[model samples]
Each structure stands twice: as structure tokens, then as C-alpha cells.
Target chain A: MDSYQVGTNTPIKLKVGIETEAITMTYPFLYHSEDDDTPYSMISPFDPAQKPGWKQLDNGNKVNGKFFRVVSFLRFFNSFPDEETFNLAIQQVKDTYEASLKGGDVSPYMMAFELKSFYKDKTCVIESELLLT
Target chain B: MKKIVLLSVLWSSIVIAQSGTEPTAALQNIAPPSSPAFVLMDITPSNIIVPENIQAFSLQTISAFSGDSSNGLSNNNYAVEFQPYWYVKRERMDFFKYNNLTTQKADDSEVTPNDYTGYNIFGDVWKRFSVSMALMNGTFDVLPQAQSYVSVGARTRLLSFKTKSQINDIKSQYTAYTTFMSSPEVIAIFAKPGLSPSEINTAITNLETYKTIVTDFENTLQRKPVFALDVAAAYSHFMGDKNQDLDDAFGRFGVWASGDLAFYTPTIGTNSHVHIYGVFRYLRDGLNLNEASDLFIETKTDYGVKMELELDKLSFAYEYITRDADDNNEERSIGSIRYKINKSFTLNGGFGKNFKSDGEQVVLFGIQWGLDYEPSVVLGAGN
Candidate 1:
């Protein structure tokens, strides 16, 4: 909270503390455009997931839930011309994560995954990563 | 060009292991730090590269280290440096000719000479503090007199604060320093061609012909991350020459802040990469030329921005600058190319155009190199 000088007459000591969590997770997605003033696409956070193009991914492996879904089809759509590929990439990430947990047979597992979507011109890419512990 | 190249080859090889260090950005008397990636922006030298700003250089034997290696960290280190440079440039007016004039006349019809060639050679010895000697000489195409100067001075850091960010491994530091010089006002008068000698002397002199106390705060962020950022701020006060008339020595004060941001793209390979960088600088100057007035209320502010890109060892940079001055406003755009040979050497060339339709054009080329040696590291006596 306070800063002080360190010198021959004034000695100083420093300390740092860190807190770790049981579940370490991240969701990554972005809206990119060549013109910085405008976004490629945006969705209303208040809108319902049931809206057209908004669909949930299959959590057959029980690894995903409302709080930890790998794919939000609508959210990933329309942002890039390769919408289908983007959706597929998200689905593949979910499937791979579930398969890994099921195959590893660990209750509390450590896993990381990424979903990537690129612009039609390939000038830019929006990527997001998730880490599960 | 051939003669220059041969001389450089011979000079560089013979002085491969000079003991001194390159100049520090904190002091305007010395050349600014330049690199292929940050050439146009004129980046500041890091503290490690110019430790003279962190601590004073003193005789190591006098403060000799004990058997305990820890004691060595507090001892003085020494270094020697020698660098020579040549520059050619031209402007619409003989900026250096009427440098000492108190007032300027605005007459477009009265064309004046502007071509110039500058030569400089500097050497320094540093221990607890550092003392450097420099000789600067230059010629004007139309002016009958060529201004030149020989200067010697010493500087030391007065105070400092340093911290590190654990998450990003960013190191931030703030330093305050005072430098005193015995050189005549000639250096200031001739440093810039068109700049009035009075203005330069008033601005360059501290308590002495060249007395300056400066405070600099800087933060260097991670270079491997998505973006690398360096930011710094400085405030300087110059006291006029004591030998000159009180009014003639009217002092000046200045403040400057700058930032350099480099965005790194995903690595293409081990040795090759692409980076886009933007640099910005703002400077404020307050000057008083009247001996009767306590201080000149007249002030000027200047700002500039530079954008650069680097692909492997080749880089290009463009900069735009605007200065609000007393007589007239000045603006210019300059573009430069750099080829970095290694950490210690670089070749640079650049051209500048005045913002005016009929503004002057300038061309510049230079070679930069330096040598550094740490006694403890070189002798393997201490860490």
C-alpha cells in the first residue's frame, strides 16, 4: 500500500503472496475487423441462447456444462466467413477434451484447449483458450 | 564513401575491445541510443548499458573489494569509450549561421545557405562518476564562420528507485542525476544550425556553462510477449552561463515524456520475426531571454510520433514531428532505413522533408558502434 526509498541508510524488505484455485479455466473469443472503428460481429449478452444460430454443444462425456461449455455455435458464427469451420473447431476441442478426461480416468484433471477462427482474407484470427484443472 | 569505409574498418578492428561505454540518452550532450528497430524513435540506452546513470564510477582499488563477494556489488566499476561520427544535412535556411541572433527576420526572398557537414569525436573515462571529452566541428555552405567546440564534463546519478513486476518480469526504475560541464557556450550555440545561440545557451546551461540536473522514470516490459513497451519521462532545468551578462544567460526549463511500443507477431523461425512499433514523444520548453525579467514566460511545445516495422535485420521507420516555436511553427516528416549488423554495429540512412510545399529536403547517413567492459566480469574476480 505504501512505497519507500531504499538506500545505504534505509534498508527495505519486500514480500509477495499468491493464491491458487482448484479449477483454472479461461474462455477466449474475439471480434476482429480491419477497420478498428467497427467490430466484425457482436452478440447481445442479454439475448437468450435459444436465438437462431445460438446452440449448445453435446456434453456426452459429461465434461461440459452450462458453466463450462466448449462450443457456443451462435457466438462463434457470423463473426468470420469460415463460420462452419469455426464451429467445427470448437466442437472438435470439446470432443477432444471429453475424450482426454474419459481416457485419462482422472476425476480432477489438468487440460488445455483452444478454438480458432480466421478472417476470410486471412489477415487476422480470433483465438480463445481454456484451461481446466 | 570508400575512404570512409576503409577508415571505419581499420578503426573498428583496432578498437574492438575499447573500455568505455556508449552515451546515455539522459544527457543531450552525447549522441542518443540508436538501433535498427528503434532508429527513428531515438530510444534511450538501458541502465545496464549506461550504468553511469545508476551509480558513480570510482577507483576500484580505493574501494577495493574484500574476500566477501557481496562487497563487490557496492564497489565502483570503470569503463572507457571512444566514438566518432560524421553527418551531412541541409535545410532551407542557414540554421546555424544566425544562431546567436536575438530576433529573426522573416524574408522568403532573402535565400540563405543551408548545407552542412558535421564531425564529432568523443572519449570518456568512467569510475564512480564519468568524465568525457568531445570535439564537435561543422561547416555551413554560405556562412563565413564555422562553429566548433571542445567540451569536458562529469555526471553522476543523485537518486534512483527500481522495482520489478513478477508476473511479467518488467523492471521499472526512476533516476535523478546532476551533470556539470566546463565547456564554453559554443557547443550549445552550434549544436543546431538555425537555433539561436542565446536560446541554446539558455536551455543548455545549468548552474554552469553546462549544469544540468535531470530526473528520468522508465519502465521496460517483456519483449517476448505479444507487445513490448518502454516508457520514460524527464524534467530538466538549465541555469544560464555565469560569465555572460545576467540577461544574456537567461535560463530555460524543459520536460519530456516518450514511449516505445513494439508488437511482435508469432515467430516465423528462430532468427526471423516481424514487429511493428510505434513511438511518441512530447517536449515542453520554457525560456527567458531577458536579463531583467525573472524568467521568460514564452514557452513552446513539440511532439512527434514514429511508426516502424522490422523484418529480420532490415527495418524501416517514418516519423512526423511538429514544433510550436516563437517565430514560426515547424513541421517535418522523415523516413529512414536501418540494417543492423549485430548488437554493437548498425548502418543507417534517412531523408527528411519539411512540411511546407517548398520546404527543404535533408539526407543523413551514419555508422554507430561502441565498446564496453566490466572489470569484475572481464577479470573473473567477482560476480
Candidate 2:
């Protein structure tokens, strides 16, 4: 609903809000510039001790353009009881993000979070795209 | 009848004693697979069961309880089926891989629907796995009167195969959707200044092209697989009479497999299919009580075939199954009809002769419903 001004030196801040009863998780937002079609992954660092909630992506020079696309992947959790796997996956995602900050090459963090096989449908994919001008 | 009432009261007392509350909520929330309820009613089309759809959480009751003598509360049966997968949490880190958006080509080409078909098929099997539990009050052939029993069961799809047409249809729909998303109209809507998320959604959905493409794609996705195989197993336990020490006797144990061959029948309706099913099961029965009130076991094997015509919201099916045991052979022939009143509720009825019925006809009716809870999504600006 909100459009961003491109070509400005000001940083672009994008925030997403979710309303759901299920546990919610999100992947790093993918930013694609009109100048270059390649998608740049933007990660929002979180304090491990705090609860996960809305994530804000702040992009400075990388997002300065007339038009760009922001792709976000959101997952909602269901009542399936596999907490062990969920906790482990969350930890791994955080670990991968931390490693990437140190110039790690592996993009394993890009893999979709895994759940026990049958409960997959309990989850829904909200793949949204935001257009900036 | 007196004994049945006493056993029902005893079971109710036990439940209340354990939970310290009235059993109304708990009783209303139990649902079993329709096939098993048929078996309990002695009107099962076949002993080998293959449930059509499994919900995350479902509830079913045989007779409505009105807290009055006329409503048959004592004879009520309740069962529940749930998928454990929905109970677990899952997180996907590799978004590109899960959505099949990753491409090796350097040109930044968009991923096609063909890229998604494989992932979808792989996920379909897991969605079919489910577990069920039921509490029922009924009379078996060897029992002098109705008694309470409990059953636990599980089912899963063993194999599923879709036709080439199904795959191609998905690909075509995906291509259309991709084109529609990038169309000038869509881009203009997104480029509009000061448009709210809900407003944008409404505008897009109101478009004729958007509606057609989405509805067609969804309908295509809902088509039945050309062929599928499913397996299930269940075990039930009988509770002894009210006056005696509770005899936790094994009531029935059954393991079965079923295969379905379905053909799309769009001529009848956009969402219609003709299905042929084959099933086989091995069952061990122990509800038979002798004069001394001791339970005895019987081993039997059953095989059957069924034909069903599914027309959008209604379906009609007929099946004949033969049961063979060491000392006797019995047959079950039944015709059944089902109508979906809505997404959350359905009505089912079946009539015919059951195994060992000695030509006595049986008619049974049932209802199934699920507790529908869905998460809502809202898009807004970041503060």
C-alpha cells in the first residue's frame, strides 16, 4: 500500500505485519532492483533472547532506484506437535544468518524450513510482492 | 435395553470422574472415519476401509443427544480423526527451493509451473496421513446387548499417480497466472499511489481475468489423481459390563489396503469424477461373548470392490464385500449416498445387508464435520 521514493540517499525501511493464531516465521526479504535483476538477500538481525515478531529491512544505497521489487516469504504454523524439529530448524536458520554475515558462501539458509512430512499442509505460503517507485 | 443403559451410564460416570466435568464438549468433538462407523452400525459396504479425506481435526456423533430420553443419548457414538503433521511446527529457510523459484539459467527467467509439479506431488502423499479414535456404544452378534468400546486407527496414502493431462493442465494454468500477474492492468494497480492493501486486492480479484484464471487453476489442482493406493489399520477395545470388573478385551483389530482408479468427468460438472475402488483386509475379532461371558476371537479376511459416481457436491456409491472365515462365509452389499452441505458439514447414509445378517436389511445414517479455524492475514505499512 505504501510506495517508496527511489534515487534518494535516504534509507528504505520496509516492515511487514502478520495477524494469525498460528506461530509465524519469515525468511529474509529478497530485494531486486530494476537496474539489476539479481535478487539481493537482506537479513534482519534479531536478539536471540527476544521473541520473534515484525521484521524491518533497512536498505541504503542498494535500494536507491526508480522501481524495484521486494519479495517476502511468510509461513504460519499449525497445531502439529513437532516442536523439536521446529526449534532445531529455527536455530539452524539463525546460525546460517550469522555465518553469512562472516562471508560464508553456502546459502543453505535459503532452503525452506522443514517440518515433519505430513503436517506441511497445516502451513500456508504467503508469497507477497511490493513495488517501489 | 436396561443393560445398555447401565453400561452407558457407567461409561459416562467414568468420564466425568476422570475429567471432573460434564462430557458434553468432549462427546461432541469426536469423529471417526465414515467406513468404521459403517462397520459399527453393521452396514459397512466392506470391512476393508479407505477414507476419502482426512481433516486436521474433525468431530462426528452418531445420534444427537438432547438431554431427554427420546434423543437416544445412551446409544450415541462419537469418533475423532486428526493428522499429527498439523500439530508440529515447520520453518523453511530455503525459500527459493521450496517455491521452485531458483533457476540455474543466467537470464533471470521466471520459474514455470512445470517446475512446481514435482514438489507438489511429493507433498501430496504426506498430506494424506491421518489418525482416528472413536468411542461407540453398540451390539455385536455375540453380545446380548449394546456395550461401549473404544477404537484407535490410522491411515495413509501409499502411492499416488497423476495423469500427464493433470500435469500439463497445471503448467498451462501457471503460465496464464504468470502472464496475468505481469499484465499492464496488474502493474498499474500496484503502481497506483496511496492504494490500501485490501483495496488493491479487491480491485485485482474483481477483474474478470483474475477471477477466471484463479478459479480455473484451483479447480484443476483439486482434480483427483488418476490412481492412488491407501492403507489403514485400526484396533478397538471392549469394556465389560457395569457390575463386573472391567474386562479390557480386544474388540477388533483390522489392517487393510485400498486402491482407487479415478476418471475426471467434467461433462457432468467441473468437479466430478468416477471412481472404482478395490480393497482387502485382515481382521481379528474378539467381541464375541459366550454364555459364561468370556470373550472369544475370530479371524476373518475380506475382499471387495466398489463403484462411485462423484458429482460436485454429491456422490452415490455401491459396494459388495465377502468375508471368509474358518467356519463361515458372509457377504455385505450396500448402496450409499453422501452430500456435502458445506465445507464444514456433510451428510451420509447407507442401506443394505451386512455380514452374517441372515438376510436382515440394515440402514444407517451419519454426519461428519470439522472444527474450521483459519488464520487471517493483513498487510499494512511499517511504523
**TM-scores of the candidates in the order shown:** 0.30, 0.65
Q: Is the docking of candidate 2 incorrect, acceptable, medium or high quality?
A: incorrect
Give DockQ per model, in order: 0.01, 0.07
**Candidate 1 per-residue lDDT over residues B47-144, each given as its tens digit:** 10122211111111111111111232222211222211101111121112211111143432221121112111111111113333332222112112
- Candidate 1 chain A has its poorest 10 consecutive residues by lDDT at A15-24
Q: Tens digit of lDDT per residue, candidate 1, span A1-133?
A: 1111212211111111111100011111111312223222222211111111222112122222111212111111111112232333334333323211121222322223333323221111111222221
Q: Candidate 2 residues B241-350, lDDT tens each?
A: 76554477878888888889999999998999998999887889886655776778889888999999999889889988888976688888887777766543455656
Interface RMSD of 2: 12.9
Give the Å shift of residue A109 in candidate 2: 14
* Candidate 2: residue A11 lDDT (0-100): 43
Chain B TM-score (model 2 vs. true structure):
0.77
Task: State the C-alpha lDDT per candidate.
Answer: 0.28, 0.52
